[model samples]
Each structure stands twice: as C-alpha cells, then as structure tokens.
Target chain A: MKEFSLIDTYFRDVSFQRKDVLLGIGDDCAITQIPAGQALATTTDTLVSGVHFLPDADPKAIAQKAIAVNLSDLAAMGAEPAWLSLSLSLPNVDENWLKAFSEGFKELTEYYSIQLIGGDTVQGPLAITITAQGFVAADQALKRSGAKPGDFVYVTGTLGDAGLGLDILQDHTDVDNAEHKAYLLNRLHYPSPRVFAGTSLRRVANACIDISDGLLADIKHILKASQCGACLQLDKLPLSSAMVDSVDQDSAFHYALSSGDDYELLFTVSEEQKSSVDRVLACSNVPATCIGQINGAVGKVDLKFNDESYAYSQTGFEHFNSGESSNKHRNNAKRA
Target chain B: MKEFSLIDTYFRDVSFQRKDVLLGIGDDCAITQIPAGQALATTTDTLVSGVHFLPDADPKAIAQKAIAVNLSDLAAMGAEPAWLSLSLSLPNVDENWLKAFSEGFKELTEYYSIQLIGGDTVQGPLAITITAQGFVAADQALKRSGAKPGDFVYVTGTLGDAGLGLDILQDHTDVDNAEHKAYLLNRLHYPSPRVFAGTSLRRVANACIDISDGLLADIKHILKASQCGACLQLDKLPLSSAMVDSVDQDSAFHYALSSGDDYELLFTVSEEQKSSVDRVLACSNVPATCIGQINGAVGKVDLKFNDESYAYSQTGFEHFNSGESSNKHRNNAKRA
Candidate 1:
C-alpha cells in the first residue's frame, strides 16, 4: 500500500476521543482548546530503531515505549496528559507492523485519555518521534530548578528494571528465572509513565523529573538546575523482586544506579511538605520511598552505602560515547 | 559531544522570546501559556534526507524549509504562529552543519516571533520533524470543511515557483537567466509560510488549506473535506515571471498543477467577504489571486484553460511512489 493509504488504514481513527480536541486528523493542523488559567506543557522524544531499541523489537512494544517516554516527560512536569502528535518513519509499508503499532498506540492513548491529534508518516528508516502535550495549572507545574537544600529526595516505583531488561533481552546477562526475565522485559518494553503520581505531587513536590537516564545522571539534571547537591543512600534504593532475583547485588546496584529507562518519578519535597507528599503517594499505584536528601553543595551526588561513601565509573546512557552499551544485543537481528 | 551537551551548545538559546513561553529548553517539557478563549492549532511535518530534499542539501535550507512547512499548516488553519518544538535526527556531529541549521531555524523563529519551546536531538538518519503550535480565537479558526458551493477560490502568492525550483535544482529544467534560476531555487529552498495572510482570512475565508502538495492536490483536500467540488482556471494560475521565463508553458502549467512544495495558502471566500479579503491583500507583500470557484458537485476538480476543459495525468506527490523525486540527489545516499 501507499503511504497516505497506510496512514488512513492504521493511524487514522486511533484517537482516545479527547473532548478538548476541536479538530483531529486530516486537517492542515489539529486544533485543541486549553483550559483557562492553565499552562500547556509539551515534550518531544525520538526513538531510533538501533539506538533506542532493538531493530527486530515488536512494533507494539516500540509504539508503547515511544508514547510512554514522551508522556514520562509530561509527568515529570506535573502535567496531566492531553493530546499527542506522532511522526513515524518506516522503510516500507508493512500492514502487520502498522496494525500492531496502532493497537499499542491506541491502548496507551486510551489509558492516558490523550487524543492523537495529527501526525505525518514517511518512507525512511524506522524511527518514532512523538510530541506529547499536557496541561498544568498556572502555579502548579513542577520544575527541576525548585529543589531546596532541605528537600528530601524521593522516587516513585523501582529503578533499573528496564535497563536490566535490555541486558536480558540482548542475552548479555545470565538471568535464569523465566518469570523474572519476563517481568524485567515487560518493564523495558511497556513502561508505565507516572501520570497520576505526578498530578498528585503537583502541589506537594518542590521539584520533579522522570528517571529515563538512570538515577545518577538524571538526578544530576535536577542538581545542576536547582543548584543543590544530593546524598543518596544506596541501601534505601527501591528494587523490584524480579530485579533482585535476576541479578547479583553488584549488577542490581549498577542497574538501579547507573542504567536507564526506569520511567519512575524522582521528585524532591521540602521538610514542610514531606508529610503531605507521603500522604499523596500512600494511595498511588506504585509505592514511593525516600532515597536521599538535597544539600547545599552544588552539583554533588554523594553515594552512600551502609554509611560509607562510594562512586561508580559510569552514570547513564550518552549517545555519542566512544564505548558501546554493554546491553547491546549479541545476535542483533537485521531490520525488516 | 554527548547528546545533551550538543543540544546545549547548539540548540539552546534559540528563542524568539515570546511572552507566552513560561519555560523552554533544559526542562523535561517546555511550558507555554495559551491566552484565555484561544484554541491551539498544531501541525507536524518531517523532511527526510533524499526523500524531502537532496541528501547533501544545505543544512540551513533544510532547517528553514522544515520550519516553514509546519508554519504553513498553522497559516492554513488561520492560526498565528506562537511556539515550536523541533525533533532533529542527525547522522553524525558536524559543527559547521549544526551552526548553519541553527541560524536558519533562529532566523525564521525570529521572523515569526515564534519561540523555540523545546525538542529532542538524536543520532540517526538525517531528518527534521518540527511541531509548530499557534493560537487563534476560539470562534475564528479557519477549517477546511466550511466552504459553500458559491465561495470563490483564491490562493496567496504564485503557485509553481517552488515546485519548478526542485526540477531546476535536479537539472530537469533550464533557464538562460541566472536571476530566474536563483529566484526559483530560493522559492524552493526558503518558501515563506503565509502567516499574516491566513490570520487576515480567519473571518473572511469559508475554508482554507496550504498549497504544499501542488495547487490541484492541496485544494482538493479542502473540497473533499468540505464535501464540494471546484473549477480551477489554468490561465489564472499565478506563476512567477521567473517561472514562466525558465520553463515552457506546458511544463510550467504542469508544475503549477501537479508539482509540490509551494507553501502558499489556498482559501475560499464567500461573495460578501471577497471585497474585505481583497482590501486586506492589496497592501500585503505577496498578492492573492482568484483562481477558481467551488461547486455542489462532490470531489470533482474540473480544470479549464481559456474556457476549455483539461486534465492532467498526475495529481501530486505520494511519499511511497515507485519513482524518485527529481529533487533527490544524484548519488542517492543511504540512511545512517
């Protein structure tokens, strides 16, 4: 089939039926209404086939991850998901691939109640770029530059499972248990963006970010922006049971600390609002745990292990590093 | 350089300083404030290497054209350009190329007073996907499905210069005058999005669409959505003097009818609003020309030359076409 027809068959009519969308697909541009006294938050992320995921990975998984990561950006800003525009490039027209991708996109958009406003599909190498937009109150949008010295650093859900999942998928790690393997793989392939948790923290958390680039690397973004330091207690690091079962302590620690793609919310709350944040997360789907404390020492990330200080060689993923990712697939399949 | 640092060094500080942007780059998401009673009009377009332009095309031209096309979509919707997010995928780091691209992007953003909110940069095949957001009064946004049968069809600027420019660039056409060649080439490389013309038409136009995919192809989009037909006068097509001097009459007409990449606005105006639209256009930089009439006949595009019926073999560009566009580079390069 042709490109336009392919879009008509797969991408059209896939909206989640958002009421704020005045016009959807097939227009010059999509039209949406923003609520009064609210600010619009938008984020764009592009996931390349080889760089971001396995070339042979499932289309549905790719679609879900693509949307999730962009949505995670919104969540980081304490924005409620609203509308999205997807720009997809493929080598050729594959009906089955498109079908699976649409299903995955439809599922996530429905879950988030975000309508797919408009997009463009082209003939090229595989890549998915999604621009996800959301709304936050004028005064309630979370920012990274608001972390105070007295703030308690907290993270929602566990970290490193998705990064480990990548290792397992690439067969670089010896993960014996199938259940643990499946759980980690799911975490890697279908991460749930911390949407509700972010909205809940809007008025409670002083600063926020979603952990996509490992705990250390991403937290540094907060520190750099907020001009504060952090003391992370490694012992308090949250880990999924599957992560613990599938890897050794050192590997698990490495994954949780330096590996990436967790999609969990990492936020800071001042001493005054710590109780309020705790109350908010008590009813959230994923549990929240205090893992560190912000300090006056700017740009410092002091890692503590059983009251002793330590450091690691690597922080997180960097696209232009001379070294390759240890999680790269061993028998990497050729792109279809 | 790392991806984040690359973005900071090159893409950061490229803003038009629009007051609506609350927060821009360096955050998880860019925040912008939309005024009360305004609807957000958004459009996304991707220009791929060898697909949208020559593989070795100037980075500045690529950046400018990419931004311009997206802005044209907003203009078609009668939305004033407000903010933008650019997702750029590059094959590798080229500092010279990056500098030129930023200059091109910055130039246009400054011209339209559109702020660069935020975006993503990645290592992949060379492609630029820009999502442009604009605002229009809730009741004044133009749509493609509003034209009546009696509306007079009009188009802003000349129709075929940019289209023929591609042919000239590819050595498919020739002109004796360097000035003519340069003019046509400039149109292709730096086509202006009719932002002000569109805003003026918000109340005057019954339906509107941008002429990106040729006059016939894009105008048909309006007719199809509005459930009407059109009669286009071939003789009345506004061809640049350079275009006429550069190519044969038949080829120029064909380019005007079937070639793409002219970012002019095609809108329909009712009899009552025709005078107002003319008044608005009389003092404009680019002139608008009345070229056709909408009809009750559905999905029909009857062409006439000096009051005689005519037909063309092709409609417009289909991305998945078997034939390569002439604008494609001689030694077609592979995707990175």
Candidate 2:
C-alpha cells in the first residue's frame, strides 16, 4: 500500500467532524480555528511496540490507548479535545490490523467529538505518535503550579486498578475470577481520561494533572511546580473493589502510590472552592475523593495511615534506566 | 538518565520564547494562544533511522532534517511557523549525541522564531516525530485545490540535489568535485524549507505544495485536488549547479523527476498574478522558476522537452511494497 492509500483507507473518513477544523487530512497542513478567548493545549505521546505495549497486543487496544493517553494530557489542563495528528510507523501494512486500529480510533474520536485532522503514515518499526490539540479558556486552564499551601488534594475515580490490570496481563499476579481478569485487562488496555471532570474543575481546581505517573509520583509534580508539599492519607486512597479484592492491602497501596496509568484527574481545591467542586463533580456524576493536603514543606511528601506515619519506598516508571531495570520497573507500572 | 532529567538537561532551556506561549515544557500539555483571525496550520512528520537517513548519520543532521521537513509542510500552506511538539524515541541515551541533536534543534527553532512547546522522549528504536503548528490568515491560506487551467506552475530553488546527495552518500554515484560533493551533501542534510517564499506566495499563488515526494509525484497532488492537469517543461526544471555538474543529463533529470526531499515550494500562479509573484519572490531574494502550466486534462501530467513530448515511466516512493522493491524504489526518492 502507498502511504496516501493507507491513510485514505483507514483514516480519511473518521465519523467525527468539528466546526473548528477548517481543513483536514489531505492538505499539507491541517487548519483549525481556535474559538475566541481560548488557548490551544497541545501534547504529544509516542508508543513503541515493545517498549510501550506487548508485540501481541490488540491493534484496537493499542490505538485506543495511544489516543487516550494524549487526550488525558489535554484533560489535565482542562482543555476540550479538538483534533489529533497521528504519525504511525509500521513495519509493514496489515489491512486487518489497520481496520481494527481505525475502528478503535473512531470510537474515541466520535465519543469525544474530536476530529482526526492530519498525520503521517511512515514505513518503520511499529510505533505510533499522536499530537493532540484542544482548547481551554484563556484564564481558566488548570496548571500544576496553582496549588496553594492550604489546598486539599483530590483525585477523581479509583487509582492502582490500571497497575493491577497490567500485572494481571504480565502474570506478575493472577486473578482466578474470569470477570475480574477481563475487567483488569480492560482497565490496562482502555483508560477513561477524566475530560468531563477536567472541564468542570477548570476554574475551580487550584491545580490539576491526570494520573499517568501514579498518585505519589504525580503529586510531586504539583508540589515541585507550586513550591509546596503534600501529606497523603494512605487509608483514603481510592481503591476499586476489584483492586481490593484482588490484592492484599500493602500491595494495593504500593500500586496506588507507585504504579501509574490510571488517567484519573489529580487536582487541588481550596477550602472556599471545595463545596463548589463537590457540587460540580456531583452534577457531572464523577466521584472525587480528597486524599491529601498541600503544605508549605516544599518538595516533601508525608504518608499517614490512621493518623500514624507510614514508611514506604518505591518510584514510578522512568525511561532510559538500563533496559533490564527499566523494564522490570515498568512491568509494575507499564506505559510511557 | 531518567526521562525527566533527560528532557530538562537537553530540551528545557531552549532560548526562543514566544509571548503567546502560556505554558511550555514540564507540563502535561503546552498551552499557547492562537492569534485571532488566523487559522492554525498543523503538520506531522516522522523520520526513522535507516529509513529516512542512514543509521550512522550525524545526530545534528538528523535533528535538523526532522524539524525542517515538518516546517516545510507548514510553509506549503503559507503559514507562519509558530510552535513544535517533538516525540523522540531513542534506543539509548548518549549525552554527546543528544547535545548535538539539541543544538541542531535549537538552531532551527531559533532561526524560525518558533518555540518547542512540548514533546515526549521514549526508549525505543530511533525515530523522531515532530508536529509543527503555524498560523495562516483565515482567508489567505494557500490550498492545493485552487489551481486553474491557465495557472503557471513555479518551483522555488533547485530540485534533486538531495537525491543526488543521497546517492553519493550510498556510494551509488561518485562526485569528483570536492565543493560539489559538499554542497550536495549539505543540501541533503540541511534543506532550507521555503518559508519566506511560501509566506510571500500566500495571496499570490492559487495552489501550492512542498516537493518532498519528487516533482512528478507531488505536482500530481495539486492536479488531483484542483481537478486539473499539468504540462511540465522538463528542460526548464531548475537544477542546482551541484546536481548538474555531478551527473549526466538523463540521470539528473531522473532524480529531478522522481527523487524526493527538495523542500522547495511548488506553486501555481494565475496569469494576472504571475508578475506579482515574481516581484514578491524577487523581494524575498528567493529564486522561483516557472516550470509548467496547469491544464484542463484532469489528473494527468504531460512532460515536454523543448516543445517535444517527453515520455517518463517511474513512480515516486510508496510504502508497503516488498522491502527489497520498496527500498530499491526509495533509493531514487527516499524520505517518507
């Protein structure tokens, strides 16, 4: 297949179309209009076959994860997803794989009402790089640097389920329940980015980021940027019933604290805005739980369990460590 | 060499700063404000080692080519370069290689006055995916679909030097002149995307595209989109002194007709606007030579040499043919 034919066959007629997209797909550059008083949020993520996903992973799942991860970045900034440019490098053309991938892409793009505007289809190793662009009101963007010392740190949805899901796939842990196994695999393969909650928290949340790096490690981003620290309540960390039932408390907490890829919004709300955040989240039907508090102890993180200090040591996934060590570390968290 | 430190060390302190960039690297997403009345033009390109360039190519050259090619697409759309999001996948971390690569990146971004807003660095087979965004006036942006039957086709600068340069590098062709060899190699390694010529042609040209897939193949994109045909004057093709001096007439023409990566703007100007285009290009000090004319024969291209019909039988690079065939085909017009 020629590059143009490959794009036309699989990506040309995506179901979603947006008014803001002035020109799409075939042009030298895709043209898009940003609404008045809005800023564009741009993010790029690359997924390599062996490094980011197993070689045998489903094309549909890989496609969904690629789009989901970038959209999750936009959601972190309280942006409304608008368009995506995909650069797909394939070792060879496979029609069935392309079809499944396109279907997966269409599903999320339609659900999010975002258009696939432009991209490159190249001949190379199996990898996908997606640059997602979105719009947020000029003054309403959520940034990691906005947290104040008195702010309450909160997270939408449960954490660590995706990590456990990855473990299940790698056979690092076993799930006897067929339904549990399926759910865990789904969690690992398909994550729901907190787009709705993100927009709702735009002006309300003091700071925000999606949990792609684990609760403990990602919160440090907020601390580093805002010049504050956090005290996280171990008992309050939201653990899904699936996770709790599948693993012991220590293992579940470890995954929640150090493992990544949850795609839930981790944000901060001040005392005065807490009620409004709760009300807005409730209206959006997304559960958000306060699990920590920001403090003046810059760059420090304290863990407490039942009002007593808890000692824990583990780090989230870091790329470029020796492949052996990095892979071992990533097998616990698993996506970059 | 963790991901964060790698980014901070190499990409964090890029000198160019744009006032419209509200947030840059280190965030989940980079935020930038699009100027009102301008549509954002976005393009993505991926360069994989051993495919786009030799595996042993200089890191600096590879980096520059990666950014320049994407910018070339923006230029084709007559957009003013603005920002870039880069996704880099590397097999390992080499500080010296990264320093040279970042230096090359810094040179282009600063020269273009564009900002590196965000990107991803991953551990995988070497590949660089850059998504470049620029701005074009909503009504003045050039499109490939606007050529009329009487429009004159023009191309800025020379063609096929890059292809010849590739041949020299691969030892398929030999260049005796030291200066010519250096010039040809430089052309291949450091293509100057016609940014000035492109922006100058915005209101003057009816249709435009950058020559990346050989003039014969790329002009067909305009022909297809405009529902028109073209009669290319083969003898009139602008050949760089380096290209003409290094190869025989037929070989030079073959590369000109079928080789890719010239990064020159190929555009069409109506008869009435031709003088204005000439005047504008002259003011920009960029040589744009008329090489063809658009006609009514939809989707067809006729070649002429000194008013005699010229028969040419070769296609541009197409991905997914057998590796042996495709690689052989690409040797003439590589870079996807």
Q: Count the backbone clashes (under 3 Å) in each candidate.
A: 0, 0
* Candidate 1, DockQ score (0 to 1): 0.79
CA lDDT of B140 in candidate 2? 86
Give every prediction's interface RMSD.
0.9, 0.8
Candidate 2: tens digits of C-alpha lDDT, residues A55-131? 98999999999999999999899999999999999988889999999999999999999999999999999999999
Per-residue alpha-carbon lDDT of model 1 for A73-152, expressed as tens digits? 99999999899999999998788888999999998888878899999998888999999999998689899998999899
Model 2 vs truth, CA RMSD: 3.2
Q: What TM-score goes with each of the models?
A: 0.96, 0.97
Q: Model 1 clash pairs?
A: none
| Candidate with maximal TM-score | 2
TM-score, model 1 to reference: 0.96
* Tens-place lDDT digits, model 1, residues B107-169: 888988888889999999999999999999867878989999989999898887887777767
Error of 2 at B293 (Å): 0.5
